[model samples]
Target: MNTSLKLKLGLLVFLLVLSVVTIVPSFYSATPDWWKKYMAPEGLRLGLDLQGGMHLVLKVDLKKAEENSLELAANDLKDTLSEQSVSAIRTPSVSPDTVIFTLPNTSSIEQVKKLVAEDFPDIDTKIESQEGSFPRIILTLKDAKKDYIKKHSVDQSLEIIRNRIDQFGVAEPVIIRQGEDEIVIQLPGVKDPKRAMKLLGDTAQLEFKLVAEPAGLNLNELIEKAKKSGQWKDGEDLKKLNRALQNQLPSDTTISFEKEVDPQTKVERITPLLLENKTLMTGEMVKDAQVRIGGTFNEPYVSLDLTGRGGKVFGQLTEKNVGRRMAIVLDNNVRSAPVIRERILGGSAQISGTFTHEEASDLAIVLRVGALPAPVDIIQNMTVGASLGQDSINKGLTSGVFGTIMVIGF
Candidate 1:
């Protein structure tokens, strides 16, 4: 062989080897997860048409998502103000597109002006001068702040919903924001569409609240008090009470009405065991949950394992309040009222209920998913069968082979 030709052949061989080393791994990583069942990494994507699976176009309710975000922000703001000894009048039964509040008499007007500007920069407020001896603060969004709230709030909402879905334990879910205000959730091989919807659609914000026994206080009277004071909406009151029970209290204690002792009694008015604004527990500290059998039966119940801080808190609470009933409230509804039989210092606890194994597992899944910062609206869902996925793989392979053949022929 001529010297130049020999060099050319050597260079070509080296390049071929390099391509095999680099390109092969690229192909492996690019393999569709669905295709992994057949062979491992044959590369490329599977289309819905070829797969014969469901194709869904989800319309993201941007407005709803934004509202959810605002609601969360409002809650956070309310909590913050309450913690600072600044009371906020409960949000009126009006559209969430606009939220309003009244400041407590103890609140400093000048301090509020600075705090409102600093704390809730997104919340544009217009403060009225001492109008007839009563100085009032009006909160409404300016154009720029409204725009900011819309986009950022939607993004945060999408992230939270995505986290919720991923934690659903589905093998390979495709959850992505389709547009500025929309999300696309694809659950391949999901057998139960209804279950998936139920899990995802629920806005579960678990809170631990000290119960307050209405005692002699009439339900109608408390309702009227909530209405008249303008400082407490029923829902807000419920959430606030739960948050107090979960984490805000100084001592690791919880208070529930002695009435909750009878599991059979569904309707009972029981006061929470602890003081207001005290949180003995929160879902944020829970690391994971599973359906497990208790020491008693093969009967199913949810086993909770707390994160480090949560474990410490749970242990302390259990140790301090050994004889009290802790209210396990989910979205303001009591799920279980379990007594502190003993101090649980192991960083794990189980919630027993009138639940089947499946129900326990489902509840476990929900707890494992963590609480969302705000609510979520499921705009769309698509499920792909295994057969359809296989068909997609075959069609994709055929197309690739034909394309390669044509390229070689050329």
Candidate 2:
């Protein structure tokens, strides 16, 4: 080869080698703590078909949300009438905020119309008289309220579901709202498919009750006794209680239930049990949560850092409830119900469990993400064994290498 040609050929060879080496390593670079081996080389999350795991399509129950919304509107109307001294009123039937019912001889159609128009004036009212029958006032939402309800109903539902899934201890889970009322959740490398399904399917609405004050009793001593006896069964009846407790609380305290909800009124009242704002302190308040170090040689523990608000809440709650058992409920199951020894205002907490390093890490991930946006229905679930995924990886690597060599030679 001529001297100049040789130099040019050498440079070309070096450039090709650099591309091959750099490209392959770039494809195999160490992933972030959140996006590890399970992630695709291109920074995109790999689908089940590519990496192999469970893929689920969840159809969110839109009808159920609508029904709940109307029930809320109806309850609001009942309360408004009761407060206004309207007697002999029955529970109203609702269709998206149109409350339909008859008042007894005490109230006339005009009086009811005026009542609704003045008090619950957000909705439209139509008063009609029936011969030999009591007059009726039909209250429905205005166009603006209807549009807002239609817009936010799905979004709120999705948020609650997302919160539940994030607490489920699934690593690298993908939950997305699909159509108007459908959700899709992808769990990668999950060993227990049923566990994932159960967690995602759960409606993990949380409540904080004033553990009814023991009369003239030593709270600290009683808490200690309860702790020793292990009487607080955190997981046993939460699901049952959640379902049965609906619509039972007083109107002022019932956050999730309403007798008459309308798109026009959008009367959403926070239950007394909930914080005044009706928002729960979430895991996003956690800056970071990781496995703790330096216990027994192989012992596992989880350490957490809370955001400012979370730190304040955790600190205050722990301070006042010292010696009392506070249940750390995730997805409505008591993950840990440790006795608060003192205020944990330092924005950090440590939870010790009989877990492996991997298990502790997984739990940290679960607690860190907090909750999902909506309830997810797992329409499909498939578990691929580790060996199967490995086989696919082998085949994929072989095909890639063969194609590369063929391209080079040709």
Candidate 3:
């Protein structure tokens, strides 16, 4: 061979070797340990349509999202009033589109109306029914505001779900808004469809609220009554129970369930707890969450780091609420209720519970990814089997090999 041809042949051999090295890992499940150290551990992955995986269509609960948005706006409005020294007769009560509250006098009502007009222009204030001498001011979200909330909610859920799936190690997940209030997700090569679904659909809304302990507020007795009466269904039991509890306990408090997993038997139990409706801090303030191994018995737990503002607020909350139990709630289920001993500063918190390492890791992933903007309801679920993928691979290889031989022979 000439010098140039020799160089070309050498380059071809080197290319073949490199290709073999890269392909071997993907070609075999039992790859050599040295290949992992020297080359990429994982090869280029096939997409869901090619490799077979789970396909899901989810609908965002826009109504529930709207109600949640209303509640948050109401809470913020209530805080603003307190900050401005404009006292409402009670905390702002939220409807689907309205925030209703009463002021003790015309002065307070005017202040609130002015505040809404100036700061909350998207909100329209109406002086409605009266409680004795006080006037009930209704704050309704504007059409434009409602539209924005709806759009932002779907977009927000899309991004949060994408982030979560990315953290879940899914290589090429197709997460897109399907329609006005629906999302489509295709997760490729997912062996555990149930776990993926849980990770994607779980709202993971985390809130820290003070445990409401009132005189004669027997939560156990209330739960017993609920159990005795099978009239309530569809998780509407919670709404009815809360309404009943409000007749006895403070309106600012509601009943929540604490999920406890027995370490020895690995059985799950739910215990009722009365928690303040006011959320002192939310998962929005969480800067990071990690799974840590610690404890007297060395258990896995999710530890949290908070933002600066969140840290300050948490410190203040713990300081003011010392000797009272603060409930760490996720998705309406209380994880732990620890009495504030002193000020828990440093923006750090540990969610210690009876959970396995995998569960703790998943918890950390969701917490780190932050809560979903809204909950998702699955409309369709399809599992793609691996046989199709194997068939595709076989056909592709046969065609490729046959074409290569034909080219060389011709």
The CA lDDT of each predicted structure is 0.60, 0.55, 0.83
Instruction: Tell how far residue 407 is off in model 3, in angstroms.
Output: 2.0
> Could you report the Cα RMSD, in angstroms, for every candidate shown?
9.4, 12.2, 2.6
**In model 2, what lDDT does residue 7 have?**
98
Q: Write the residue-wise lDDT of candidate 2 on 296-385 in tens digits.
A: 545667887887887887788777777865544444333444567888778876666455576676566555554443344667666654
Better of 2 and 3 by lDDT: 3
Best by TM-score: 3
**Each candidate: how many clashes?**
23, 30, 0
Looking at model 3, the pairs that clash are none
lDDT at 141 for candidate 1?
50
Error of 3 at 203 (Å): 1.4
Q: Tell me the deviation in Å of residue 17 in model 3.
A: 4.0
> What TM-score does model 1 achieve against the real structure?
0.57
- Tens digits of per-residue lDDT for model 3, 1-410: 79999999999899978877887776587987888667856675788867889999999888787777667877888889989887764543544567778776776766787777777767777897554666788776778877887888899989988998998899978888887999999999999898899888899999999998888867787667765776343356577776655665677788888878777788988788888878899999999999999987788999999999999999999999899999999998788998999999999998988978888888999999888777889899999987888888889889989997998899
Task: Tell me which of candidates 1 and 2 scores higher on TM-score.
Answer: 1
In model 1, which regions exceed 4 Å deviation?
A: 1-61, 64-88, 91-93, 104-107, 129-134, 140-173, 217-282, 308-326, 331-333, 339-351, 372-374, 379-410
